[model samples]
Target: MAALTPDTVDIIDPDLYVRRGYPHDEWAVLRREAPIYRYERANTDPFWAITRHADIVNVSRQPELFHSIQRLFVTINEEGSPAPDEAILRQLLNMNPPEHGAYRAIVNRRFTPRGVQGLREQIDRITAEVLDGIVDRTECDFVTEVAARLPLAVIAEMFGIPRADWAMMFRLSNMMIGPGDAEYAGDETILETLQRARMEFFQYFSQLCEDRRQNPRDDLASVLANGLVNGAPLPIFELMSYFALLIIAGNETTRNATSGGLQAFIENPAQWARLKGDPSMAAGAAEEIVRWTSPVIQFTRKATADTNLCGVPIRAGDELALFYPSANRDEAVFDRPGVFDIGRNPNRHIAYGIGEHFCLGANLARLELQVMFRQLAERLESVESAGPLHRMRSNFVGGIKHMPIRYRMRPRA
Candidate 1:
């Protein structure tokens, strides 16, 4: 393969992601040769690419220095789109600490480890129901048949959405984040697909919000619809953006992680067998899978003030893209980083990221992965890749889009 050059390291190019898996080799080069690399493209802004794990951590920890409030999250190319409230994206994805903390606190308790663990039986039930759909099949596309359904079910239930609408939500999420992919967008440009999806999302969620207000339930949607932020009920746009984030972010991250995690198990039979023997290893297994997948590819931050990162000078307002996939594979952090290990100890992967902006749904996502994999380890007789694996042609949120897996399954308990 030819060496990746400056022109090819944008990290947000959808073509590169479709052709290469996670851009590992290119990131390795960046980490060792130029950890704070820079890249520029046509009609796009030039920004510093933060590749090394430590650099990502440093930037994340100091949110005051690297602010997300500058009207962007990771990529400027996809910024400034039509939505319910065009400005709400900033409030949701780019809020500063004081404000970010307030909104995050609205429903934070429901996503904590304790809160998430409380739903283990429910998660297990959801997993079981989804698995039952595929139990009799000799071969299936695990991507859609199994992995995609689990997160949609869990999150839909959380949002108090009707079961009938879960599939719609999942489809809208794909169209929202995957405009660059033919499977999702077909011929639509990024902004066009995103705007179209946003309209659908706004139309549906707007009704749901009103319904929740009239008939509140013990769900996240009801909470957000009725809840107040800073002595004021969330503005309509903020409310809509919150729902949009939940639908898109909530679905894509976990969905991709599950799909990619299953592929990992099939690829590393020994690791799969290890888990089969000891289901308790599901904890470490979750971290390893998230590390391996790193579905939420890159998170960006804008410099609030001039500073230096690992001796590299940075200017105020400069965007820094944190390549989470690369950080997870940093050789300095994990032993044999390239190899997949279900039982890797001290696996300090920054997959969910660090600092205040760390993934709020991390606990829930971890629990979902653990429960699903544990069930597989118990009931799965054997499994392996059965055909060519296809990935979502999306650069931001991506994973196996079509994976044919041949597997034998034992009767469910």
Candidate 2:
């Protein structure tokens, strides 16, 4: 193949890609010709888009050589440079090892199998409540009414956040993740909605921290408030940053995954039937959904030194966007790369990522999905589309923004 150039490579406009429905065909072309191709926008720094599974895994495994501390995504600010909020960037996902491992260890205990196992009853109750609301309404938007709300509610409860502020938090999360989406676009006034959301989040968590210090509780917020890292109590800013990270990471990703899972089952009715027939397949089906949706699409890594990835040269400070969607669909890895199979065994897809930066909340997410699906499958007598599905205009975390579904509810025994 001819040497890939900036001009030859596709300069994807995030907004356009989301609006037009990001087809996998273009990605297939890029994977073959320019697996590590340079993509430059008129007003943004050039980035190398890594589309192949091997390259993504290679980059992720070498956290020392390919640093995540620079900036975790290909996004740029209004000044045509990487955003300068190091506090925000230092969250679990963007931190390099040692520091990352230290902070992760503090909160890891809460998300363990033992910890999450305790939440099974709570999750079931919440799932039942959400389903009850949906059952009464003949038609409803699955994203807004069902999928989106449940996770946020669960997350807020986990954090001990006031119930009244849950909607605001959800809105802020949407703005943060949906910046490229046309619906989320706001007036280019003082600051971006995402930045505003970050400030709001910091303020809220700061108050929560103070409260926790005065009266610590059993919730995650209290743990964060009283938690120590590197043998010292976490600083206030770092605590707020950690809270911000948890809120966004815990709430939005799961919301998208749940919404996406429902859509997948709807699209593949036979697979849905198979799952419905055998509820034991819920766990496997959840894995397939994550693999199929591939939420948290791309995370960036900065090359610490000059290196070659899959025969392509990369220089120090060069940014590489590890496209998880592409990796999950790699023909070499999956049997039927395009097809969605509910009972796919050994589904080692990198949806939650891999290596050092693997999602800390992976178990929590899996448990949530398994329980949610189990409840839905058992209680929903019939489910079908009521209207067209509207996908969120986001490249970072992509899924349905709105799905109108009509369902016949089965009575709870």
Write one digit per residue (lDDT tens) for candidate 2, span 1-413.
77554355443456545566554766777777777888777756788988888788988999999988545666544542225343443578778888989999988988888878888888888888888887766788888888887778888899899989998888777766675555664653213655677788888888999999899999999999999998899876677888988888888888889988898888899988988898889999889989988888789888999999877788998888888988888887889989999888889799989999988888888988998898888887788898887877656677578889988887665
Q: How do the predictions measure up, each by TM-score?
A: 0.94, 0.93
RMSD of each: 2.5, 2.8
The alpha-carbon deviation from the true structure for residue 29 of candidate 1, after best TM-score superposition, in angstroms, is 0.5
Best by TM-score: 1
Residue 190, candidate 2: alpha-carbon lDDT: 17
Q: List candidate 2 stretches off by more than 4 Å.
A: 1-11, 41-43, 76-89, 188-191
Going through the candidates in order, what is the number of backbone clashes in each?
Answer: 0, 0
Q: In candidate 1, list every pair of residues with a backbone clash.
A: none
